[model samples]
Target: MVTALMELKSLRKAYGETLVELGSENKNIVVLDADVSSSTQTKMFAQKFPNRFFNSGIAEQDMITTAAGLASQGKIPFVSTFAMFATGRTYDQIRNSICYSKFNVKIVATHGGVTVGEDGASHQALEDIALMRNLPNMTVIVPADYNECRQAIKYAVENERPMYIRIPRINLPDIFDNSYKFTLTAKVVEKGDDISIISNGDTLIESIKAGQMLKQKGISAQIIHCPVVKPIDKNILKLISNCKNKMLFTVENHSIVGGLGSAISELITDEGLGLKLVRIGVNDQFGQSGTAEELLDYYGISAIKISEKVIYEMKTTIL
Candidate 1:
C-alpha cells in the first residue's frame, strides 16, 4: 500500500480522456452515446471529434445497432451509456448485432452497480457483468480505478473484438501508478499466504481497506485485483489456491450470483481445488436509492462489512 490514501477521481473522466486521445490519432475510431454523454463523460470525446461521434438520443438499443453497423464498416465503435440501459435494456441488440457478428464494438458502460446512487433499483446495474459474459464474443472488463480504466479503454480499441467495460458513477482512488503495467491476468495487490481476497472494480477499494484491517487483526489476507472477469486468470488463481490458508473470499459490487463470486466458485469447483469460497456481494437483491456509502453498507459491500466477514469466516473455517 502507498504511504497515504490515494486521491479520488472519476473513472468515467478517465475513459473520456483516453477516448479523446485514441480518437485524435485514429480516424477509424468512432464513438456512440445515448444522450448521457455528460454523465458518462463521453461528451469530452464528442466535443473533440464531432464528425466521428454519433448520438442515439436515449435509445440504447439503437446505439448498439448503430455501433454494430460502424463495426461492420471496419471502424472501431465505442458505445457509451449507463450500464443498466446499455446492457439489460439492449441485451438482445448487443447479443445479436454486436457479439453474434463478432464486431469490434466496445461498449463503455458507466454508472454500474449501486454506486449509481439515488437512481434507485431500475438504474443500478448489478447484472451487467453476468449479461456481458454470457455473450459468446464479448470480453468483460471492470477496471478498478482511473489508471486501469485508461489502459482498458486503450486496449479495447487496439484489440479487435466485441467488449464491455463497466465503470462506476462515483469517484475512485488511484490504485496503480504510472509505472504499473496493465494485463488481462489477475494481479495480486498484496501477497499473503494466510487467505485470499478476490475483487474487482470500485469494490476492490473497499476490499483493500478490508485487507489492511484484517492484517491489524493478525490475519494475513492476500488481496487479488481481478480486472477481467470473463477470461479469469486461472494460472494466478491456481497458484494462490495452494498458498498459506486454503480460504478464498470474493467481494464485488454486483450480485453474488452470476458475478465475480460465481465465476471464482465455478473455477475452484471445476479444478477440484476443494477450497471454500466466502462471497461478499448483493446476495440476489435489487438496489435502492441512497448515497453510495449507504448503499454499499446496506448491500454488505462496505469496508467494515467486508472486514467483519473476513474475521467471521476465518473463525468458522478454522473451527
Candidate 2:
C-alpha cells in the first residue's frame, strides 16, 4: 500500500525533514554520518539531538559497523554519506555486518549518480543500485523526486529488513504534487500500450519527458516509476508480458549491468516472456568529470538520446 501524499521539497531539505520527523516519533532512531553531515543534511539532526548523532569522520566502513551494532541492540540507525563511499567503500560491512546478519539499518546514500557533477567519476556512484540490490537481505529503493524520497525514507525507517535509500545531489522538477501518494515497490505513473518505459532515479524526469515526446510522434509510451528495484514487481511485469505490443525499455542513471534495466530483463526472462527490450543507461564505463547533463549525453542516457535510441529500435527492429 502507498503512504500519505507528501509535499515536494528540496533534496537536502527532504533529508533534513525526514531526519527530524523520524526523530520525533522514535527515540531509538539514531543517525550516523561519515564526516559529510552537511552534504547529507543530517547535521541539522545532529544539532537537534546530539546524543543520537555520531559523526564517524570519513570512515564509512566503521560507520556501517557501528550502525549494525546499534541495530543489533534494537536501535534504528540511518547511516549517511555519499553513495560512492557509503556503498562502494563499505560493501563488506554493509553486506556482512548489516545484511548478512539481517540487521535493520537504513543506509541513506546521498549524491548518487552523475548528479554529483563536478565531483567526477570517483565521487559519482553509477553502480550503487547494482551493489545494494545484489545483497541478499537488502531492500533497495530509488525515489523519483524529493517528495518520494522523503516518503521512502520514512517507509524505510519503518521497514524491518536492511535497506538502502538513494538520493541524488541535485534537485530536479517536482514530479509529484503536494498531495501525491508513494508506494514502495511499483507505481504506474502513466499507462500506454505501444511501449513501456520502466525507469527510476534521476533519469525518471527524462523518462517522463520522453513519454511526452513519444506521444507527439503518435506512439504511446507508458511510464512506470519503479523506486524499488529489488524483489521484482511481478504483477506489473506480467501485465507488460501479456501486452500485445510487448516492447519494453528500462532506464536508469546507473550501468545497464545490474540496475533497473537488468531487473526488468530478469523479470521478463524469468516469466518466459519474449519481450523486445532496450536497456537505456550508462554502459559498463566510469563517468568522467562533466556536468550532469553532459555526462548524461556522453553516456547516452538523456531524454533525447534515449528517445532517439528507442525510436531507432522501434523503426529498425522487427518486433
Candidate 3:
C-alpha cells in the first residue's frame, strides 16, 4: 500500500470537503442530490456552491435523468443518493440515460451494504456492486475508509466517467493516517505466505485485523485492499494467482453473488489458479433492523468470522 499523504477524517465529512475541493477547480462539476443532501453529507457542497448544486427531492429516477441531461451538456454531474435508491430505484435511468450515452456522470452512493444500520434492510444496499458491475462502461469503486474515499473522490473528479463510488455510514478506522497513498486501482496492505485475504470497502479493516490475528497463530495471511472494483487491478490478480499459498479468501460487506467475492472469483479462476478459494460476505438474504456492529456479526462479516474462515480453509486444505 502506498503511504497516504493526507489527513484522515470521517467518511461523510471527507466526502463533503472533497466535493468542495474538486468543485472549486472544475466549474463544470455539479452536485445533484435526491433529498439526501443531509444524510449523504452533500449539503455542504450545496451551501458553498449554490449555483452548482441541484436538489432533486426524493425522486431518484428524476435526479438520475437530470444528471444525465446535465452530463450531455458537458457538465460533470455527480448524483448523490443512498445506495439502495441509486441502484434499485434508478437502475433504468442509470443504464439507459447515463451509461448508455457514456456520459461522465459520477454516482456517489452512501450508506452502502449493512453499514447503514438502524435503517434496516430497506436502507442497506447489499447488491449495489453486483448490480452496477453488470452495466456497460460502469466503473465500480468501494473505498475502504474515509481517507481512501477522499482520494477516490479526487481521482473520480480528475478522471471522469460513468463511475459508482460506494461509502459506508459508520465512522470507521483511519487506516491511512497521512502516510498512505492510493492509486486508482488495488492496494496491497499486508503480505503473507499462508493465504491471501482480498477485500474491499468497509470490510477491509476487518480483513486487516484478521491478518494480524493470523500472524499471532503463526499462519501467514496476506491482505489486499482494492478500492476500484469494476476494472479490477489485473496486476494484483496475477500476483495473488502465483502465490505459494494455495488458499484464497475474499471478504465484502455486500452479498457474495455480484460483489467483491464474485469479482475475485472470476479473475482467479480465469487465470487457471488451483487455489482453494472461499468467499466471506453477506449471504443472498436481506438484512434486518440492527446496529452496524450487530448486522456485521449477524451476517458473519466481522473480523472474528474472517479469521475463522481463514483458519478453517487452511486446516481443511493443508492435509
Candidate 3, residue 133: Cα displacement in angstroms equals: 0.6
- TM-score of the candidate numbered 3? 0.95
Return the clash pairs for model 1, or none: none
Error of 1 at 56 (Å): 0.3
What lDDT would each prediction earn against the true structure?
Answer: 0.89, 0.84, 0.85
Residue pairs in steric clash, candidate 2?
none
Superposing all C-alpha atoms, what RMSD in Å does each candidate have to the true structure?
1.3, 2.7, 2.2
RMSD of candidate 3 to true structure, Å: 2.2
Report the candidate with higher TM-score, 1 versus 2. Answer: 1
User: What's the TM-score of every candidate structure?
Assistant: 0.97, 0.94, 0.95
Backbone clash total for model 2 is: 0
What are the per-residue Cα lDDT tens digits for candidate 3 across 1-319?
Answer: 4343334346877899889988898899999999989988899999999999999998999999999999999999988999999999999999999889999999999989897889899988999999999899999999887778888888787786899999988877777654555575676788786678888888888888888888898888878887878887877766575457777888999999888888888887798867677889988999888988888888988888789878877777763
**Alpha carbon lDDT at 91, candidate 2:** 95
Question: Which consecutive 10 residues in model 1 have the weakest lDDT in total?
Answer: 1-10
Looking at candidate 2, the ten consecutive residues that score lowest on lDDT are 1-10
